[model samples]
Target: MREINNNEYHQWIKETKEIIDKFPERKKSFKTSSKIPVERLYLPSEITNSYLEKLNFPGEYPFTRGIQPTMYRGRLWSMRQYAGFSSAEESNKRYKYLLEQGQTGLSIAFDLPTQIGYDSDDPRAKGEVGKVGVAIDSLKDMEILFDAIPLDKVSTSMTINAPAAILLAMYIVVAEKQGVSADKLSGTIQNDILKEYIARGTYIFPPKPSMRLITDIFKYCSKNMPKWNTISISGYHIREAGSTAVQEIAFTIGNAIAYVESALETGLEIDEFAPRLAFFFNSHNNFFEEIAKFRAARRIWAKVMKERFNAKKKKSLQLRFHTQTAGSTLTAQQPDNNIVRVTLQALAAILGGTQSLHTNSRDEALALPTEESARIALRTQQIIAYESGVTDTVDPLGGSYYIEELTDRIEKEVEKYLQKIDELGGAVKAIEEGYIQREIHKAAYDYQQDIERKQQWIIGLNAFAIENEKMPEIHRVDPIVAQEQEQKLLELKATRDNYAVTSTLKALKEAAKTDKNLMPYIIDAVKVYATLGEITNVLRDVFGEYQPS
Candidate 1:
């Protein structure tokens, strides 16, 4: 970092002020979601480096530019559309559809039951099976979910936490049955339980036990599944839950710090598992700020890994991430307007250098996207990659004065947050004390106040008025899907060797009682078609459950 000469900057500002003072300004101030003020005009003088501190090249140390030298030039960002709903069979059709439409990877969304480790047959599961996303009660459902899609050929991302290991076990067994080796598997699991406790509220065990499960995955995957991304520490949900952009990066990086420290405590070398770590982020409506946030995220994480963790490998420091357009910004009133919102957000993700992206369907704020809407969302990504010329260069907005300044602001703000979290004893303690939650809640409240005061405009939500906007037909899941799922679980239990199922679950419980990694036991249990609830129940009896205040 270099300091700008104030003497030179003052002279430039004085000379420029005379001509600029004659022009009228629109607003008193312009700022980003993180509340950093943007200058009316950015010059090389505003850059602390005096615009001469050697900016590192792309793929170099600190990775301020990008992780890849040939970002989107040799290969475009992977198009992994998030799609899953109804039963595994139904979701499988959707996955094949997306793949045929030139989607490069698969992103699976589990129904609430599976997310919380419930079998479809559990009384607690009731009407929720297959409603929000795909329901996979056992290996049987996972097999149906993948169907003819070869796991070896396609990378998959499963958004499952708390019971992430169980779901991951199911995925591994499915691939094995497809004759794919575990080493051949490539994908990411949202095994990040910290964010769930902070925002999503889908946790199963206490943070201590939950963290143990996460590190166990880290150990197992490091040895067996080398190509796999062990965890996607997420800021996407945090932003959706209404944190400012700075808070999103701050809290997410803080959580990553906790995970790294936990892994080191487990006696695993940093390089042994750091490269497998990844991130998930939101691409919100603020185009330039969103791009700057991504760039800042990479730079911050690189410094943290190198300076704090003492990681040697460049891969260990690189903050590879997937981006999804913000669902929170979508408006049900002007449902059609969401397409434009998604396009801008998706474009920001690309310009900011995401490894992959998921574009939200315009109708998602209303219901599960219909197939037509999903296709339109995919088309948005395709058009951006092919027709939009922005992908021609790496970090096209990298050198812009506004972008660099904004990126530096976000990076500094995030550092202040990290220092605060450090004083409170890391991410878990900050979350347990509700510090992170309170911060996000306060920001969200302030944002709502701005909207109400007409300081912040939300197009159809605030500025535009529509008295009787006709609503489009939204997709509705068949109520019969739950009953069908329940029957399948019952039939599988009755037909399979019950003794084998019981034995594997008992082994899982025994392993849970000890210091052994639990993934193998989970794999064995799911292989015999043991219900998800049964496997989770064994752990629940051992590790107990987590209930936040």
Candidate 2:
């Protein structure tokens, strides 16, 4: 790679200074734990022209090194622990507890009923309300879930897909009640429905309408909530469902390509909606492989946005993402072993230059994390941020020979997968044809076979011999949580203006039939305190439900 000239170096320093001004670096020594001095970044003694072209400086195009000029130096990645369970009131308390424990952001996990757009009182929602996550039925429930939490103060990521629009509308209405404008909201909604069909099974509508909802979110957020991430095209579920690192990158980018194309087809400018796009990835067991996957993902996304879509803005080309440590890697046999695994995976994510991260709790493999376990998980991030000198530099592992070689290999493999996906007529067609599902199923089955054959070693599982391990206390949702949530919904329905609810539902159903954006209608329905099921039923009537063949 060509050597960076003195003038170029000075220009970069100027930009770095501006970032540091906004987010001052931590006021402490930038040294190793043993007090060994460390540089802000490490570079090779000699440079070649090709190296510079491939791994340009941080914050530059094809952002292989990092996105920001002074990655963690200017500011550390957001520590967002995913939390939610039981009723909205209970989840609200947990959110407060996590914030007090030093979490920088909130990642909400909604229950199955909320995810699929059913009211807590719906017959289909019986016995499942607040089981896996917090159950939200209407604006009343959303208001309770975020009770005292100011939306403008903390970024919140909601893991909702098919019903993302309705939940988002409810959130917006709640913020308005708190005097927080839509423009001030900063967070992401996992609004990518394609992944639900591919790996997860939380999908509601068919692919055509699902794509429409995603692009509508892109369009609405671009015009109103500029700071909000419209859709977090996710590979976390794919990896959890048993995909290789290369498959993770390929499938994610393929889905992203499909989203961008759909938005463009709707007459939306690529740069307008692309800048708000975000990604979600999983950091798995292999230390170096996880880091390489993140770097390779960024480089591939940058090139695709700029070269394929002709994106003009720098933000549009930059691939910002949030990383969560692999839930699949956790072991139920020896739960404490998961802490070590999570630490390794978390470090890899930081080293790979993630903008935000959530480290899984040690007890998550067995159940929802207890308060004590959640604190330990948050402390894991705190220890790494404050003590571990990893945050002192940008892309600490960027120049490692193994990392570089692995990154290149992952990128090439992803390109091959993307080419195949394109040939299969993009992500939507690939899913419709069961091509993507088959690939992930095969990989998952092969992985299981390897573990059974002792070809792969998972500590405390196939390799380690442990007997009668004592179980730690796990968080359990109250059995009466469903009854309480159902009662709350019943009370809401009894008091709310039935006439207004009926009117809004009618308007929403009509809007869903036309090509017009449905965000405004959704917002209107939510404002009238229409339940999630009520709003979704309107859409389900217009757009038939999706059933996997």
- Best candidate according to TM-score: 1
Candidate 1 lDDT over 1-549, as tens digits, reads 777588976887778877777888776464344477876788776778633332377888677788999899978888988889999989999999899988999999999999998988788998898888999888898999999999999999999999999999989998999999999999999999999999999999999989999999999999999999999999999999989999999999999999999999999999999999999999988888999999999989999999999999989999999999999999998899999999999999999999989999989999899989999999999999999898898888878989999888898899999999999999999999999999999988998888897778888988895988899999999999999998997799889999999899889899999989889889999889988899888999998999888
lDDT of each: 0.91, 0.90
Local accuracy of candidate 2 as per-residue lDDT tens digits, 38-78 = 23333332223366587999999899999999999999899
Candidate No. with top lDDT: 1
Q: Which ten contiguous residues of candidate 2 have the minimum total lDDT?
A: 29-38
Question: Could you estimate the TM-score for every candidate?
Answer: 0.97, 0.91
Ten residues in sequence with the least summed lDDT for candidate 1 = 46-55
Task: Give the residue spans of candidate 2 off by over 4 A.
Answer: 1-49
